[model samples]
Target: MSTFDYAITRTLDAPADKVWQAWTIADDYGKWASAEEVVLDVRPGGAWSSVMVLPDGTRIPLSGSYVEVVENKRLVMGMDVPGRDEPVLMNLELAADGEATKITLSQTFDTAEDRDQAEQGSNFLLDSLTAHLAA
Candidate 1:
């Protein structure tokens, strides 16, 4: 099998610490992890789960590992979305840029389908995060 990857970058008006908090805290992720509503179990081997319940309702569970957690700097993990049995690697970097934070997400998947799902899912989450951080 071949591997595929997708990446996205976002700049938040908030500081790196703030952005890191938003990404790490369950309560904060509940606010930013989706364009709608989501439930994230943000622990070492917990869940990276979600339920889209605004405009529509859908429940999707993803599996992963909190491979790395570097406070306000970086986070690396693995994820396997619904219907897929293989987990992909997800790396998130949070860097300070003056008064703002630059967030970059890179996802590596085992196949095209996995890559596609990651792209769609990550973009959705980014959109939600943008809205959440803006507020």
Candidate 2:
């Protein structure tokens, strides 16, 4: 099995609390998550949904379950893409850095292909989030 790791860091102008709220609050999350169709149930065992609209307008649905959550600190979830037999674990970390916040999103999978796909997808979403947070 192959493994891959990818990380992106953004210095948000807002404080850590604001950035944490942006991630935990449903309305704020939808604004930055980048999927045309998105849903977030932020509690443990809550369900989440995201439909990414491709450049050609094709909608890709992603569904998942939140397995763990720590207020203002971390979020752990299991994500399942269409046609994928196994769910991938998603771990998000939030930290305060002076007036800025450092957020980390990591995905671990059983296979290399899964890890690769996750890196690409997370990169795209993180880029969108950076723009959103900056604005």
Scored by lDDT, model 2 comes in at 0.77
Write model 2 residue lDDT over 1-135, tens digit each, in one string. Answer: 566666656566667778777766767776777465567888999998877676678888878988999887788989886678867788888888888778888876667776788788788777767788789
Worst 10 residues of 2 by lDDT: 1-10
The C-alpha stretches of model 2 lying farther than 4 A from their native spots are 82-85
TM-score list, all predictions: 0.79, 0.82
Q: Please, what is the whole-model Cα lDDT of each candidate in the order they appear?
A: 0.74, 0.77
RMSD of 2: 2.2
What are the per-residue Cα lDDT tens digits for candidate 1 across 1-135? 777988899898888888887877767876666423444555566566544444445554444667677788988877665676766678899889998988898987677886897788778877888788889
Highest-scoring model, lDDT: 2
Candidate 1: minimum summed lDDT over ten consecutive residues — where?
34-43
Q: Tell me the spans in candidate 1 whose CA falls farther than 4 Å from its real position.
A: 35-54, 80-86
Name the TM-score of candidate 1.
0.79
Residue 44 lDDT in model 1?
A: 64
